[model samples]
Target chain A: MPITITKSTGQKELLNIEKVKHACRRAGASAQLCEVVGQEVKQQAKDGMTTKEIYEIVQGIISKEHPPVAARLNLKDAIIKLGPLGYDFEKYIARVLAAYGYNTELPPILQGACTTHEVDVLAVKDGRAAMIECKLRHEIGIFISIKDTMSTWARFLDLVDGSAIGKCPHIEECWIVTNSRFSHDSIQYGHCKNMVMLSWNHPKERPLPAWIDDKGLYPITLLPQLEHNTEKSLIDGGFVLLHDLATADPSLVAQKSNIPEETARDCVKKAQLILQA
Target chain B: MPITITKSTGQKELLNIEKVKHACRRAGASAQLCEVVGQEVKQQAKDGMTTKEIYEIVQGIISKEHPPVAARLNLKDAIIKLGPLGYDFEKYIARVLAAYGYNTELPPILQGACTTHEVDVLAVKDGRAAMIECKLRHEIGIFISIKDTMSTWARFLDLVDGSAIGKCPHIEECWIVTNSRFSHDSIQYGHCKNMVMLSWNHPKERPLPAWIDDKGLYPITLLPQLEHNTEKSLIDGGFVLLHDLATADPSLVAQKSNIPEETARDCVKKAQLILQA
Candidate 1:
């Protein structure tokens, strides 16, 4: 008999070893390591066990053998720890988009046709501009709803009208970016409106996790040696991406973040190790 | 020098005795009483006082003499006390619309063209149908924004498309009803979209307070003798409107609410007293 495991959404499904392997592979584990993790998870699988428990089991195994892979697997939770407020997440997104070759601006208050909007991230590349609305949810299992997408579309429409009347610059595309998942209705509405929707795992071709991994653009919060105060200082000092700290002088980072030079150096070293992996 | 008072929106304006008199008159006070209250408020007024403090002063003076009018004056706070959740507010709105000669239904999950929508109130009258969205705010000084209005418009559009394709009932009008005020941008977008906006003091001529006063459809939460548990029970028992409880038999009210008959009778009498005023 197959063991039924509960998902984050509270739906029950038979535990699939292949899914466990896939998650391991997605976290940059070796094929052999993936197989080992999969077999271990299958051995420990029990009826009515939660997927969160399965994740913890896998994390415990990977952290001992391959700390870099374990850090990659902790990406989603790390993103969540970035907020109770979304300001840091927005800054992180801007840095990620900057790495993607887009000249990004943080929170420009642009006048639309009817009113003004404080856009989260304005990315312009090669004569194409995109208005990105970043929604960061701290808790797990909360999906961005259709109302959020609809309002984004409405604001985009207003900006388009403003462009025609010369009130604001022309924005060719509107995007909804979130650190969480999008609800089914939100995806449906987004596609129907032709608005680019990016979340943790939507638009399966290249989701947010894939985007982060593709550029090795992990957040500074992903550093295991990072303390809460240091993390806040680093983020407040505009070192949102791990790469930002990894490349900066330790003394400069210390000066900007109000942290000890030794602590800044340690964070940068940990960030470099993960990026190198 | 004129005393400057701060509005709920945090904008400072010179104190106007005429506005105080208007508020008292609107609360169903006699003209002579309005003048008396206005004069008292003016005498006690000081620079930098908030509108809420002014309201409290007026409420205190009125409660001492005309308790019924004082109950009416307490309408906004009473409506806020109905929430922490909006379930009772939706029911209350249905009753209010019903009193206005519209056949109303509570929260029908209608299938729109793109997705399903759990509409707050669906009201039909004179062969015209309307979709009412109730936005309740428990806190003061928070205004309903354009994002809210835009999303409401988007959902209405989807329903209209559904109606055209024979998926949902035809909705000719979309209304946003809030217990608080609408932001300037919200009002602008609402008017631009031709959406009906009913807020605390919007539309200039008739607003939510006027609507409730016109039909004497105060909520059961307005009963002073009503305890928290009894209020919950009464609301759970489907007696949202004060008139519903006032007209119900004391025995029935007690049985439904799990309260003593005497308490129920006292609540009904108090409700009746306010309604009579």
Candidate 2:
């Protein structure tokens, strides 16, 4: 039977079980599991099915089989839903830094050589401070260009110069953090300038996704069925991570978000599964 | 007297006549001309002066002393004003190619291996066909990235494959034309793939600026006092090149652009002087 799969944007496309199976396999699902999911999905599928509906169906099965892989595949889309508010991204990064034993500040004004600069994320650990330039990309295709990397480098230099002149505290390190990939030139410039670069998939030694997974610091947006308003409330209530939700009482989540208790319970359950994976 | 000059975006800074002179010198002005212009500009300048106003004053002087240099300096800005309309840029590229003895088409639909691709500018000359990808940047700081280069290569390969399958004529060359610089990776990718890159300042042997200046095919944005609407009308009327405007009857241009005859006359005069220089 032919069925139209609707995207989160409300645009619809004809559902292709083969494509779904391929995606599942790419996410590290076993071939046998992929076939089983594909067959089940086809039977349950209906015309004008929303992608969220399809995702929920598939994720439910995948989380049961291989929870970690499900979380990894869902990460990109989860990060994207956190937006329309850039400040929240800064907060999220601050939280990530905090998990690594760094006392983090969102955006602090520090005197640069020429002017006052607002450093994105300031992390202090072991008596050394790092001025991090947090570049958040909502779109997957957007790569951090060389110009941005250069601008960060200039800012770092200016801040260092400020410290040399005793205008601000001396920074021991500079870092560029992004949720997406950096352009080749950016990577090269960062390495040459000795600025630590952390991206979603880079330096392989300490990628952002692996770091987030290790700390169980997934953004609240990663919880499936978390409404936009609820996400905002959770963030405002100082609950920004999936780990927070996984550990919180489901009733507390429902009260904070004004969401149905059963839905909140379901979300908490998914978060727990993802964290375990 | 010191004056704080302002930018179009309202950013203000102290005016420096020496900086203006340096700009003129970089634009190929003579030392004497630069000095004279600097003195004249300083005298005419006041606090709260905009960069646009300064450009006009300096351009007026340079066009009188060295028209070609004036045209060359104005080239980058002129090409920029051709947008918000990307199609105008493609047409501008077509005119440039035409000057080089190539008949060009804008966005001709050519079959790729799996899908139909709309080639940006297809140039035919000497019994060889070239598929050109015209990458235009509206902002100055944006650089063409490696992903774009790779996408163009993929399209070129698909087009070549299409020819193998008898879907279209064989393309003997693939070229990327941009009015901005390309990232290091883009340049490297182009070289490795043997794809010809023609940018504002790349491939050192022949840059876009040099090619346009050599052909005397300056875009009409070079006209100092050309109103935005009139420029659009002139471009729409097929008067894309400065050479075309310079050689056309002033009355004809006035009629086409719905502007006064005298203004058209002055524009043509400036164009002629620039060409002579």
Candidate 3:
């Protein structure tokens, strides 16, 4: 008889991204890890570390137990702290494609014109490099102008044409993305190239999926920020200037320009020694 | 039928613009005017002027013709003495449009944006304004990067939208222009209900057609340098160097991690005694 295989009947445990999100709490914390990632520890990547090694790099980036010195730094620095492991995410994405048994090379990003006009991640496998344009469109589209849409779309076309990059093969696809629907021309440009487009409008939405080898092209997913507003973020970051926001609005200050409304009240409450003859 | 009306035998006597050009020659000259229209004064428009007036303004502009000095100061000193004609060219374009019979306003220019963007002119007519954006495109487009296209297209959109005009009325049209062909998307944005997209790329193209109007709608055609590229108009009005062009280009010099190019060049060219040592 063939070797029998058994399937576990117990409740399947799910690996939720939320569980790892605690990592965000340590975002600004600094000890040694943040420093390593910030510098992009180049030597580590050459060692052939796996993707798990990369997360470990970011995990090692900020020691929660330490002070928040690293918080002021950007994402690149966090990667550097991982030593060689910091470069994991990119390699992981490449590896996912590699698992499909296709040859792939993640080339160094050239400063000017190589793939998509403002491509976020460029992956080369076939003769044509499919430009992967990434966007975390913070500002909404209803707020942008049509002219902006046109110019941006034109740039996308230029990206597909490879006018700027001398010899990076070509961007067979031109993708445009947004946190929400942009004006018309943006979508039209992509249609002309028959490329994929992605836009995210709310939290709890699954963003684009990753590109797979042989089966399908890149996945489209939406990312949404939860329980996060500008004010809350600032407060959590400990960047407070005043406790009361109403006082900050000038119309509350008796039409005066210089004095803060609440502060003016406080000054009135304080005793002043003024005697007139 | 009286003496046969002999149409004056075509002696190729002279076009009115040519006659005005000759009279302007008697008046004086401007380098920047020549830079745009060409060598002869006759090249300037002549449909509405008294001929003498255009000649006088042209004379006022040419530094070498120094009115009181009788052309003795040479071109150098006159260059220094002149100032940019604050007579807005866009407004002039509008006037020329009106002079020929087009009803239009040049649009109001937003003040305080010149540090990065500039509005050369603004004219209004027919309850609408044409937001004309102009520039000479000779710069090289090197590498295309996320930020590069982002910024370039962003600027292009900004120009077309007339976002620079802080208090401009909601008019019927906006025109973004250049001395080059526009991409398809640019044409699309120009399709807005109240916008127009135009360009002048032909070898002998005269942008802003001279005969678009019959009775003329705006009428300030006497200014020769207003045609385009008038450095003397720049001089006639007065201007200070924003940044030295030669020093801005890095390929001209290889040295790095040193003092600014402008300062270095100043020292090298002006300080001769130290060089002898």
Highest DockQ among the candidates is held by which one? 1
lDDT of each: 0.88, 0.80, 0.34
Model 1: per-residue lDDT, tens digit, B1-277? Answer: 7899898778898988898888788778899998889889988988899989998889888898789888888788889988889888888898998998999998559988888998999999999999999999986579998888889988998899999999999999999999988989899888877889998888889988889987788998888756778888888877889899879998998898888898888888888888877
Work out how many backbone clashes candidate 3 has: 59
Model 1 lDDT tens row, A1-277: 8999998867789998898898898878899999899989988878899999999999999999899888878888889878878888888888888998999998569988888888999999998999999999986578898889889988998889899999999899999999888999999988987888988888899998888988788898888856778899999887898889889999999999999999988988888877776
Candidate 3 stretches greater than 4 Å from native: A1-130, A133-149, A155-277, B1-61, B64-93, B105-175, B178-203, B207-277
Fnat of each prediction, in sequence: 0.64, 0.00, 0.13
**Per-model TM values vs. the true structure:** 0.84, 0.50, 0.29
Interface RMSD of 3: 12.7
lDDT of 3 by residue, A1-277 (tens): 1112121222233322332233333343333444455344232332333334434544454433332222222232222221222133343334434555535454554332323233345555566565444343332334223334434455555554444446344555544443335445444434433555654321124322222212322111100111223223222332121212222333333234243455434322221100000
Q: RMSD, each candidate, Å?
A: 4.0, 13.2, 27.4
Top TM-score prediction, candidate number:
1
For model 2, what is the alpha-carbon lDDT of residue A243? Answer: 86
Ten contiguous residues with the weakest lDDT in model 1 chain A: A268-277
Which of 1 and 2 is ahead in lDDT?
1
Measured against the true two-chain complex, the DockQ scores of the candidates, in the order shown, are: 0.60, 0.03, 0.05
What tens-digit string does per-residue lDDT give for candidate 2 at A1-277? Answer: 6899876435578999997887677565779989988988998889888877887788888878887667756876877777766677888888988988999987568886655667888899999999998887886558887657756765676678789999988898889888878888677767766889999778877788777766667898877666788788778767788888889999998888677788778878877876765
lDDT, model 2, position B57 = 94
Model 3 chain B worst lDDT run, 10 consecutive residues: B1-10
